[model samples]
Target: MKIRNLRLLPLLGLTSLISLNAAAVTVEHKPTDQIIIKFDNANVEGNSQARTLSTRLNKKLAFVRKTSQGSYVFRLPSRENFSSVKAYLKVLKAISGIKYAEADQMMFAINDLAVPPTEGIVGTKKPIYDLQWHYFEPVGGMNADGAWNQLDSSDSVVNVAVLDTGITAHPDLDANVIGGTDMITAQSISNDGDGRDADPSDPGDWVSRGECYLGSKASNSSWHGTHVSGTISAFTNNSAGVAGVGYNKINIVPVRILGKCGGYTSDIADAIVWAATGEDNPNKAQVINMSIGGAGSCNATYQQAIDTAVAAGTTIVVAAGNSDDDAGNYTPASCNNVISVASTNRAGGRAYYSNYGDVVDLAAPGGETSTGARNGVLSTLNEGTTVPAAPTYAYYQGTSMAAPHVAAVAGLLYVKKPSVTPTEVKTILTSTARAFPDSCVQCGSGILDAGAAIAALDGSVTPTEPAAPSNFTAIAGAGTVTLNWSDQSTNETGFYIEKRRKFSNQWGTYRSVVRAAADSTSYQDSVFGGTYQYRIRSQNSTGDSAWVVSGEVSVSRN
Candidate 1:
């Protein structure tokens, strides 16, 4: 498969959500009053069996519809209070085949990063690169130009799914955009007179005050999805408004999840599965970008969707949120096995508006709009959605902006190393992350280094069996059981040891003894009590190898 061309590098950057004091701007994601339940024993054996299960579920619940294999969406009658929703879920979960249940939560767009005096879109006079200083100047830029030396171009088939407001028609982005989904359900919010459809067109997400139950002030359409698309593959070197990170041939699969006010977790989750599993995803996305998020925990609904995406061999990249708080408080960003990116300014300092915490994987350029769009991240945009006018380019900020930079980078790496996995993507991105030009507490491993990451892939895949450690020996002394092993693999960077208590000829569950660094072969395993047997395996920068036994040894509390 033809991947991104390393020859024609350097075209774009990412944006970030603005951070603020908890009290200044309240952006909380309230859950919808519905539940998503998944049946454990459900063997999607076929629709015939699922239809039977659905029939049985509809009898007890107010409404039951088969969403996925064993999953169903149900709601209680209005007469019953929402408090009973939990009770109903508990009872449903207790059913023989039922596994788990949770609320159909809500997710919102990264609040407006910058809204400089609203002006109708205008014409482009100067070349796009002249305005996109982030791609050339070092300042707060991500040094993207430097990385293009090693990687830049992309394959046409490698799709990066942009899960946000639907994309708009733009001179630079139109060709790269494949058809996508409109996940908005509410007609009022959709403004498209339909629930969910194939048309991923953005019909002005403008909202009135109090429209969201949050009493939020009215806001105009941000054209966010279009901007993100521009960053990923805005027909590069087109002598147009701006160049995309993934130049010519690279394509985008716009999965519209957020609309009018925002979207529900259920819809967003479904989009992830569809994009990842290639259900309706014609382009076959290798990466998914969710530049929008709201404050919330990692609910089961979001968890299952993400897990499914990962299992489908797709890398999920999410913004760390614009709220200047711990990203841990957000869903998907806090979800397991995702590349949760934080925003960094041109100086590489954590963008003040960017949410930070250990939850962040690495930092990306989520520009500070305060400096104006010229200084902020630049991408594609549209002045009107309904009639589709003012197709121009602009700069925006927020972690929302920053995520696409990484998403585009993931595409670059995939082109270079197709065998790489989601976990490996995270590892390469983080391990190769350059030190922040400035301090960024909880800003993750480091600022994203696109060139370093591509160079680091080095075509290395996890070994089937790195040579096991030899001279494996364990001895007990002075309340401590020290273990030593001889390294045999020249390529290994570390080792993992497991231990089990020897109960006569039988042994108990094997627990991890230690995960030692490459520099250390000897480990001081403190004895808790009794005799124990140990085994170990080697690990490389890629992943772990097969296990090796250390025989048996004894130690006593006395």
Candidate 2:
């Protein structure tokens, strides 16, 4: 996709806001203007200070709604209006306990719109597996082909909620999708003329540079959601345009949040919660793939929703952001409990644009578009910009493409171990990750390896008397604790392990053990409770996973 230089245009006055609508926007103070003030607190103006402030301002305020953050939305009625929105903010800031007051700002998607293939195909009998080198190349490629044979492709229990522009019609994906929902609230912006509804279809987020006061050039509709969905689950083996990380569309659940000018921060926060249905709610997504993000640290609204989803047993895999800056500055990725993924190129080196930092949990093949489509990541796409047109396949770049790879892998993990905890999934992935074949300092612990991850579950390959293991866990005992996932499936007999006391917040050496496991499902190690950690992996005629230790787990005794 080609990114046109974007210009930020702030909607400053009531006239500009009112000029936006085909009809007048019913605002708080001016029943006539469209501006809304995000107040920090509720209006019990009965309080002396509030009453005085309310009286001084002639126009009374009314409560709108409490936003995701504890802040309140209060409309200061237009008194033939006395000042500009800038002046109104100044007055509101003067009041005591007024956390913050400003107009609800607008945001847009930070994606570059590239031209689609001019000569499109209605359908194809063969999937261009070669076109998707990002999935097949060994250097940085995810071992998706091997994982497909092991995972339950059609298991209705697993579904990945794609929170992006929404998925549209494509022959390769139509059969795999169960259903979707539209979460866009701004009716005019949605272009669908509706607020929230059951239709989670992409309406093409193509925009003219002037629409949002963007100084960049106009663009064609980039089928962003469809491309993202294809990476996770485009119908495979149908001889279509491309293969997928998981199975076909059945694995994806489209949850639309982005529209005409990207989407609001508030809309995305709500979709995160909705994807994981609560009590009496039937929507149960095991993995939520937010291949979307923008600048800024996490806000309370995004923080709360992420916490709720994790508590509900959902694993969120997010893009580490395309900014190349520290992942710490991007949202949802920087948010707690998410498996943040950075992008790696064909040679296992970090993609030039992938954001990196302590927040990223792993790395995956997101591809580089500098050399054009053949070198970029290919997935599902559409020929239209504002409406649905012929189905096609195109290449795209960005950490946006990297996220679904990890999300689908998490989905595969769920199919293998339905009883696995979200914490365990993170541990196993970080543990079994294969070291990058090239230099990618701090991209994450390692690149994803599917074959090693499912080895224990399938009872296929076994481990030999070798080095250590990955994703090891312990069961507390009087003097001994047993390590987990050290399975001696079929070929080899046992495993070699290592231990450290996490002294001074640092791990010691593995010189203590020669061999720590055998022909059993787990290995037993003796220890006391100061916080012990271990590392091990299943090995065969082939080699075992990387020696990276799983994150520390606390052990205790009654």
Best candidate (score: TM-score)? 1
lDDT of 1 by residue, 1-558 (tens): 112222222222212221211111125645354567676755434345434544654523334355543476664332233355555556666767667877665566634534543321223332345445444333355545434444433432478899988888887788888868887665656777888899899876777786765446676677788888888888865544567777553579998888776776678888888888988667678999988776667877788788999998999999888778998987778989799989887667887788989898898887776644444677887655234566766667788888898998888777777778998888989998878878799999987776567667865433333577888888887567888888887665456667889776788987544445555678777677788888877654333466778767767774
TM-score of each candidate structure, all chains considered together? 0.70, 0.67
Instruction: Name the runs in model 2 displaced over 4 angstroms.
Output: 1-108, 113-127, 152-156, 214-217, 248-250, 278-281, 456-558
- Deviating ranges (above 4 Å) for candidate 1: 1-26, 40-64, 75-98, 118-123, 151-157, 186-188, 385-387, 459-558
45: Cα error in model 1, Å: 16
Model 2 TM-score, 2 decimals: 0.67
What digit string (tens of lDDT, one per residue) describes model 2 on residues 1-558? 110110111111111000000000011121111223333445533334434555756556555444443444444453223236556668777767665554433333455534233322212322255456565444566766445545454543478888888988887787767677887776756868888898898888777875643244465565678888888888766533566677542378898887775665567766788887543225568889887775556656677778888888888898888767788876767788899999888778898778889998989888776644455676777767568887766667778888888888887778777776678778877777789998777799998776556554435563343444444666666667676764424543234455677678887754223232235446566566667776655333234444656557666643
RMSD of each: 19.3, 17.9
* Alpha-carbon lDDT of model 2: 0.63
Please give the distance, in angstroms, between residue 541's alpha carbon in candidate 1 and its true position after superposition.
Answer: 21
Evaluated against the true structure, the overall lDDT of model 1 is: 0.69
